[model samples]
Target: MHLTLALASAALIATINANPSYYVKPIEDENDYARVLELSLLFYEAQRSGKLPQNNRIPWRGDSALDDRGLNGEDLSGGYYDAGDFVKFGFTMASATTLLAWGAISWPEAYIAAGQLDELRKAIKWATDYFIKCHVSEYVFYGQVGEFFLDHTFWGRPEELNTTRPAYKIDPEHPGSDLAGETAAALAATSIVFRNHDPEYSDKCLKHAKELYKFANRYRGLYNEAIPGAALYYESTDYGDELAWAALWLFKATNNTMYFEEAEHHYQHFHLKERPNEFFYNKKVAGVQMLLAQITGQLEYQKAARAFCDFSVRQQKRTPKGLLYIDKFGTLCHAANVAFVCLQAADSHGIGDPQEYRQFAEQQIHYMLGGSGRSYVIGWGRNPPKQPHHVASSCPDRPAPCGWSELDKNAPNPQILYGALVSGPDEADKFHDRREDYVYTEVTVEYNGGFTSALAGLLQLRVKSIT
Candidate 1:
């Protein structure tokens, strides 16, 4: 058995060495966490919707998607665009905001150390403000701003797109529990971030959050069926997990027993199991379990969280290069999200194996930072991607015509998308740097949020070790 194990290990090493990549050195950078955190803010700046302010960090981008007014004349103006497209998906936007806000709540010092707390705060406010606007009435909530087909037709700057973008909403008749729940979670989490800094705003946020949660619970139905437009994208399958996720955040923010009871009910209703290998916009089981374990110090929650992490580390399929594999398309995202869970578990006060979980999380993050022999982040390590599938970044500065030729072949992106993390390498750990390959080279706001959370956790662990 020992000899067989040795042979297998040697073969894996040989396979990893055979893979071709530009990065050929061990990862060693004390400033990586700071660098990534800075870049994440830049990504948010690029994805800004509505009137681009004068103080915007991304100079190349101007006012964009300003024409997005809701069907009921509600102002659906501000929020980050979803993925590489100029669309505002409320579910995804809320999920991203919740994760980003959680990172801020978990490790404010990391942002302070990196000198980006103000930027992070502004970014969080941008989304929460949009959420507040979207929740127009007791039941009515705007969930989407632009049509996928119409939005996908244009490939240039979001500011230049002058099409008639339609808006969609959810209410009692058109229920969207998942969307409402997630929006509540985002708002609840945001309230915590502003609890001390801005008491009035925090109370307002929490007030809206509670109302939205009530709406979600009262009208329990999927958004896709009611709205139909969400079917193509941002479609929600189950609303149970989202209910629990929102409830948990509300409980965290307010310490309300009612919210805790709701959270516990939904968590058990779903019969939380070992986390699946993939973490996507629609899935929140693993995240809920992990948070529950950390916050409540429950034995069941800890056991499930451990089982999920163990599945990711030991049972999940992996690339020869050591990345936990789910799909070749955005493989790094799954790893990044799970890395965050591991990192948080590592610091679970005393519920988890801090050393072991930290090691696992670090390995996954190192792979993203070039331990896989190439950097997946657009502007970080040696020979990072120069042609991410981003419309604004791919266009030349000011004068040149931004067309298919430029996107397909003419030149590398005229602007360096500083900290944008690309989708990443294939299942075999092979990468192609080009604009057309959206799966391997696209950047998203939420994607950056995941990386930011993971990096902040890493920085926190490092600081804890020294202190």
Candidate 2:
């Protein structure tokens, strides 16, 4: 038995080393640079042809479908339709900024995607302006700065809109009384952009960034004097998954040991408790943990990252028809979180059994593109053949199931999209057999961004290694 086990381990290592799919390249290098340039031309052409507009307001009408699969098949008629509000806070717009930032760092080729340096500058300006519009001066503040409202607590309160009155009073019990996470996310985005393009905005961005850090520290830290033992209430605590992302970005931009120390401190205090099994559902938290682990190279962080990848692999749902479903806790398999975790594992740890993670990612893409086609809206929902509960509202009557589709319709499906590299068994069956029906569904654009950004970061590292 020992001999057989040793042989199996050797075979697994060989497989991992032999397969490049087990390790995905980050979009940061020369190859990605060329791709970004090509994409930029396409974007420019789309703009000239009235497909994409000059402003950040997404051109949703007249071939405005961003999903290529949907557009190609002419199935882009149904699903949600609105002006490209990609500039709004607490939405995929905020996350896209992080993607752009990662692209700027790792895939500098993305800078050329604007077709020229001047165009690139315009793109940055547009993104920054949009971010600025999303800021809230105080809780319940009202303004038409962006497509989405900036008032109300993260938990869904205020119950009123368009009024100038403070929607919800600031209180310790309700640290999320305003867009705390979104605020932090905005600051991070603004900081990154300023760091690269506009030096003039650096001081302002830093000030806001520090304010965000201070807020998170004040209410979310375990040893915090202002709010002792308050870290347990993640729901209302000022810090959560998004704050962690902000910390990493801040550290990267500022290179401040304090920010790194603070980020590490939070990861140790708040995230490590759940440990390996923690990532089964919360992709945002999982993504944040992965980034922290990678940047710090802490053993505990690595262990957590491995645990998350393992849990994700184990949780894949296998359909009776022999299809593998890489969905999260609730919805039809989405690619964002799954892709991010798998890619990170493959890139960081080499995913010993390369085929397992690779095949799973591939199967998820197939199901998403083939089964759902362009209608592959990822959020939180149960596997097919299971009833989906109403978990959309903040105060839902009952808890919702785990999964990306059920979380928030507006956010990007990070469970599948970001770090996608298909390879593994068609495991769509396991989702149907799960006995636990109650699931908590909370999906925010902030978390989705962190998840994808972390995956991008991992890919960058892997690509650097291979090159």
Candidate 3:
């Protein structure tokens, strides 16, 4: 650690140790959740893969992804970019947007209390609108916006990058069930968010969701096969889990028995009864089980949910401080995702005793919020991430030179991403807040969704306590 950052960390640690909640208070936690929603939208604004909308509030970014894939003269514009890169991976965007909408649906009160309900709605609508655009036909969905080789070469704002951003899609013969199913899930979930607010829009979302689900079912293949270029990035080995996930959400949104039957069939066919241990975007079994438990109140679903939670907790690897470190690359992401599931299960009424699971969730979440001796959220709590591995954040305010040398310096990010959660510590609970180390300091919408969802659940618990 550099001497300056090291001293700053030491001072921040002393302050936090003196007061356990100094860096993690209820009011501040609510503020953090709201800020996360804001920053998630800002990340989208900074990396929008198409023409800038007139209503864009994020001033630092503008239209950039023009010449996006001359494939069939399709308009492949207006989706959130993937990570720090300008590519718009529809699969990942759909999944992240679905989870973000899930946070809104499950905890509307938290968003309202935090004064972020409108922003959350806007973010969900932005991604879902892009999904609508991606679905040009009944059986076709464009899956990607930029070529990896071309986009990876540039490390500047999305608006500044100008290159061949190829668009990829899947058709009836060339199937992409996983991507399509996840998009369907995102639309279905967002439909619920707007059902009361905008009935016409809700119907539009559900209509597209149903069509996408049909496409996913009619052509049962992974997306990478159709778009081979995506193999290196958003590849999927199986599509059954996504199918089941979409079906369940569709059933929930429309309250249709046929959708429920389809979900049940897919659930049984995929044997989700045996939940997977990982909590990343690729795997949906654990989250599906939690949702199923809540919807059906079935003992089997509850059993699976508990089994999955227990399996995650029992992983042999852990930081000496017991942070449930899953992998070095996305340590906090995995833990935060698991924490969300745990808290979701704990909130489900008539389920098994949720106290234990709640406690487990709290421990993992607290670790991310400075319980591990430093905070991982950018511009929050104590000793937060000063240097995030984000291109826009690395560059000076705008119209300034942003080079590799700028990222190498031991300085705070140029932008104050209040609620952006950085990739966290290693298995030993050690973290380096450096911009060059993307693994440790990178911020992504998906990562923020996971942590923000968990924090929303936590704040929901606090509201329950006070009332």
Task: Please report, in order, the local distance difference test score of every candidate based on alpha carbons.
Answer: 0.79, 0.38, 0.76
Model 1 vs. true fold: TM:
0.91
Clashing residue pair totals per candidate (backbone < 3 A): 0, 58, 0
* Model 1 score (lDDT): 0.79
User: After aligning candidate 2 to the native by TM-score, how far in Å is the CA of 439 from where it should be?
Assistant: 15
Expressed as tens digits, the lDDT of each residue in 142-210 for candidate 3 is: 998888898767777666775677788899989999999999999999999999999999999999999
Model 2 regions more than 4 Å off: 1-174, 177-179, 201-203, 219-240, 271-283, 318-334, 349-362, 371-467
Q: Model 2, 103-130: lDDT tens per residue?
A: 4454333233222333434443444443
TM-score per candidate: 0.91, 0.50, 0.89
Q: On TM-score, who's better, 2 or 3? A: 3
lDDT for residue 438 in candidate 2, whole number 0-100: 23
What clash count does candidate 3 reach? 0
Query: What's the candidate order when arranged by decreasing TM-score?
Result: 1, 3, 2
Q: Which residue pairs collide in model 1, if any?
A: none
lDDT of 1 by residue, 1-467 (tens): 32342344345334433541222232367336655666667678778898877777676778887767877677889898877778788888888888888888988877766666777889999999898988899888998888888877777777788667898899898899999999899999999999998999999999999999999988999988877877886668798888998999999999989999988888778765655565666888888888899888888888888877777877888888888888766678778888887777776765457777778888988888877777777756767788888877777766666655666774568776767888888878888887888889978876777778888888766555655
Ranking by lDDT: 1, 3, 2
Task: Report the Cα lDDT for residue 443, model 3.
Answer: 73
Residue 406 in candidate 1, Cα distance off native in Å? 3.1
